[model samples]
Target: MPYVAVSALSHNGLIRSHNEDSLVIGPWTLCSTETESPQTLLFPLGTPLVVAVADGLGGHPSGDVASALVVRRLARIGPLLDSEEAVRDALTACNEAMYASADDDPDLIMMGTTVAGVVMLPRAVLTFNVGDSRVFDATRDGLRQTSVDDSPPPAPGHRTTSLVTQTIGGTVEFTAVHPHVTSAPLAPESRYLVCSDGLTDPVTDDEIGEVLRVHDDGKAAFELWKAAMDAGGPDNITLALVRVSE
Candidate 1:
């Protein structure tokens, strides 16, 4: 049997009054099933799976709502879909839903969120993103980030590196969709980390690796949050760690 240890924390940070960041684990089960079904499966087709994430959107009206919406949408993919086309279609559906919610609610105007999530398959590791959030692969060698930022076109053609150009419900129209999706073979004894920019921006990448190196899931999570707090936690920090064991 494969076991996934999930540890997560959300902080208001030093500057923000409210936490705009959110982390999700097993949300697929939570969102998919209802009163009729007591047991919900996130990936019905996979044997060993770990899908999770962290989200951070610029604190705007209903940022929290937007984050939750994206996480829930991604979580409920009934069975694993191997093709990129299927995943892209799922993202498009999420965008439409988010846009509709924002348009319907006056308070949720301009609501948006950054997402970083992972999909574990039988033979490969799939990580994807829509903003500045990131997914990192942690192995005995070291840690490596998988996704790139999808910021706006830098100068009509080029794209910005650090800004968040595409996210859930950021635009009035349902267009301007930019997704950073990629897949790679899963490494043996490999661990994965998905987090919001809050954790990456305040805490150095080296520090993050060290924390993961020294502790298990719970301890690593606490240490990460502590480091961000020590650095004045300018933004809400969220982290999820997944270790694949044989």
Candidate 2:
């Protein structure tokens, strides 16, 4: 039998006043939530399961609103995401929905989010992203990024940048997106990390890999959160550790 397990957490970090990161695990979603401890969920490998994070654009009004809308929409459509085209269409719909929502509300204009996550099928996993959030393959070997970052190369001494070339919705006008989509065969065992940049921006990949190597899935999720908090916790942090076993 094949099964999937996800351990996740979200926090406002030390510097952020509120958590603008939202997450969707299957049909369950979290919005503007604070969760210091790792919460684990299990499911049989059947319907397509989406594990993703949405990071609201900082310095923009109603960031939380944008992120929540994106994640909730994903949760509603997770099971229907069975193919690459389906995933792409869903993301496109999400982008359009952002603009639609913004149009209906004056304050929501110029609000947007960066999204990244994995869609786990029975025998394969599809990884997708927009903006600079990330999905990574995690194992004893190390962490390998599976999603594309939409920002320019970081300057010297910087791990990440604040400027994003594309996002869900940041302006009043409609902006199309070419989401990065890729698929890999699911092995007898595999693990993936889907997270907002808040986790990756402050913590180095080496540190994250070390924690994953030393800890189990659930504990690794907690340790990763702690590492970000220890490193000044500059932004909203949200993450999920997904494991598939047969």
Candidate 3:
């Protein structure tokens, strides 16, 4: 059976006073202040595994709490997800949970987060995202973005465009979440990058592909962080690199 080697990490970045990003690998969850050493785990061909990154809305209050809540909710549903519908349901549940939490508390009003994740199965991988966080598929041909950003299209010649059109708990009202979900056949020796905007905002797609090609899974993740920091890590950085092999 094929297995997956994963290297996941989260950093507070250079400017943030607090880390508002969260990550999930299978059942384990890590917040901005926490870190996970690189590790590899073998899963049977048909086993279901989940890997995700959540970025709290930096402009909103309690953004970290919202991000943490999103991942924690997903962790519970991760094991149960087996199909595209299941993935949508899981994300919807997360959205509801965030809204409910915020409704019950005055301080948590307007808390929101962007979520990007993948559910890897034996024969296929399902990718999903809400907001501007993204997932990318890296292969011999090139790097392709798999998840679509839920933000307005940038105007021509407009360089500064970083506004998300939708997100979990983005508004105080109860709004249905529309997560971008897609699936593709699983292939051996394939690599996938799931990350928050912190990394994408600083590093380019070419840079990401170069790092993945030159370094192993573990080092690739670290180099990505370095690339973002070297470019002035202005936001929280979080990412997971998953490689599939027989």
Best by lDDT: 2
lDDT of 1 at 79: 45
* Order of quality (lDDT): 2, 3, 1
Number of backbone clashes in candidate 1: 2
Q: TM-score order of candidates, best first?
A: 2, 3, 1
Q: By TM-score, how accurate is candidate 2?
A: 0.98
lDDT of 1 by residue, 126-174 (tens): 7877788888887767778887866544566432234666776776566
Best by TM-score: 2
RMSD vs true structure, all candidates: 6.2, 0.8, 1.6
| Residue lDDT tens for model 3, 158-209 | 6436889989987877889988898899887878999998898888888998
TM-score of each: 0.82, 0.98, 0.94
Worst ten-residue run, lDDT, model 3?
Answer: 36-45
Overall lDDT per candidate, in order of appearance: 0.66, 0.93, 0.85
Q: Runs in model 1 with CA error above 4 Å?
A: 28-50, 54-56, 151-162
TM-score of 3: 0.94
Which pairs, if any, clash in model 2? Answer: none
Question: Candidate 2 on 10-78: residue-level lDDT in tens?
Answer: 999999889999999999999999998999999999899999999999998999999999999999999
TM-score-best of 2 and 3: 2
